[model samples]
Target: MTFDATFWALIGLILFLALMIYIKIPGKIAEGLDKRSDDIRTELEEARRLREEAQALLAEYQRKQREAEREAEDIISQAQREAKAMATEAKAKLEAYVTRRQKQAEDKIAQAEAQAVQDVRTRSVDVAIQAAEIIIADKVSGKLADELIGKSIKDVAAKLN
Candidate 1:
């Protein structure tokens, strides 16, 4: 009997299926797909691990940076306090120096005033002694008068000085 095109096509389809089954191409394909899926899953896990590691490193760096900033701020505040203390100390020293200098100047002035008073008193005593000698010489003119005058002058000099 002579078959139509449909019969030959059906035969071709069956032979192709048999040939593919004999070669185990479907099983190999399935195995290949499973292996590829496993490889993709492993790559995804590795990428996820790397991402987590990067995030952890980022967090650690951020923490360290924050600590460094805090330390820097603390150091700055400490320096400011030290500067204020130093300024206060310097001010105290300056005030002490100024007071000391003022006291020294006052002492010098007092010394000058005392010296002036002493000089005036010494000049007055000398003038009084000279006037007394002139008056006595004019009033007395004998040897006894000269001896008494010398004795009086010595007594006056001793008492005045």
Candidate 2:
């Protein structure tokens, strides 16, 4: 039989396959594919683990945010309470100041009234003494006048003291 291109090509293809089998190329290829698959599985597992860690971190941050909010609210409440207390204290101080001023004014008024009463009493006493002296001068002799004037002076001084 004459060897043709198709027959030779078929023979070459068979030889190439037999050479590959003799060298265990198929087994090596299977092993390479299995190693690649295992690597992909490991990467997938690592990605899953990273996703879980990220979720835990997210939860921790959320808890922290809630705690911050609570603390802020507490601070605000405390500030409000302190403000109210300050207002009450200020009001009390203002009331006490008003009372003290009113008391001082009353004391001043009382002092002025007392001074006026004393001045009036002094003026009345001087007027009465002048009237008595004029009457005594009109009615009494010199000796009797002197004796009466001395006794009146002594009596007036005693009453004043």
Candidate 3:
């Protein structure tokens, strides 16, 4: 038989495949690929768990923020109501003070007016008595003067009464 190039190439290919099988290289490659796939799956599961935990924390913080906002509003509303009540009470107190001062001033004025009227009446009475004494001294003499003076005094007292 004559040896050819194609026949020799075929024989070389068969010998190479036999050497690979004897060494178990295909089984080792399959095992390495399977381990890499399992690592990738574990990493994906860990990433999913971390994402869920982050989402839950964000939701709890949001709820706390809403509660804080409501508490702030309530505090502001209560402060406003207290301020309004204080203002109303202050206004009432101020009005009462003004009214009391006004009444006191009026009473003082009335007392002053009454005192002035009394002074005028007393002055008039003194002037009248002096005039009567001067007229009686000029117009009469002795016992007749005394009698006229006594009669005039009685008439003036009765009229005053």
Candidate 4:
């Protein structure tokens, strides 16, 4: 190729024009660059807000953990109290049942004793009347025998009392 001054000069002018466009022409062509930068800053602030919200959620979960632990403890304590109350009630019921059974057994024993004493008294009375009849067969009047028996019953009753 053959070099030419005019060609070189034209290339220099093109380069200079391109440099001017790169440095100064965009500002003149677009007026919203500052607004774009403000929008990007607002986006960064929104991201920070979202991070804070996530941290608050983590803190809320931790608080719920503590509350659940407290509730578990309270439930355990209540269960223990109920168990103690049940034991006390069972003991009282058992005691009452035993007392009632003992009273019933004592009443039965008393009734048996009274029936035995009455049967023995009836047998003794029959034997005593037979003896009296034998002794008084030809020796006493019926009215005198009745009086003697009445006196003997009074003496026995007084001694027993």
Tell me which residue pairs clash in candidate 4.
none
| TM-score for candidate 1, residues paired by index | 0.81
Against the true structure, candidate 2 has what lDDT? 0.95
Runs in model 4 with CA error above 4 Å?
A: 1-25, 28-37, 138-161
Clashes of each: 0, 0, 0, 0
lDDT of 4 by residue, 1-161 (tens): 98799999999999998997888876754647777888988999999999999999999999999999999999999999999999999999999999999999999999999989988987777677667666775577788877876776676656544
Q: What is the TM-score of each candidate against the true structure?
A: 0.81, 0.83, 0.64, 0.66
Worst 10 residues of 3 by lDDT: 152-161
TM-score of 2: 0.83
lDDT of 3 at 72: 97
Q: Give Cα-based local distance difference scores for all models.
A: 0.93, 0.95, 0.88, 0.85
The alpha-carbon RMSD values of the candidates against the true structure, listed in the order shown, are 2.5, 2.3, 5.1, 4.5
lDDT of each residue in 1-161, candidate 3, tens digit only: 98899999999998988888889888888888888988999999999999999899999999999999999999999999999999999999999999999999999999999889878876776788778878988988899988987888787767765
Error of 1 at 148 (Å): 5.6
Report RMSD for candidate 2.
2.3
- Candidate 1, residues 1-161: lDDT per residue as tens digits? 99999999999999999999999999999999999999999999999999999999999999999999999999999999999999999999999999999999999999999999989878987787788778887898789678977898788779866
lDDT of 2 by residue, 39-88 (tens): 99999999999999999999999999999999999999999999999999
Q: Number of clashing pairs, model 1?
A: 0
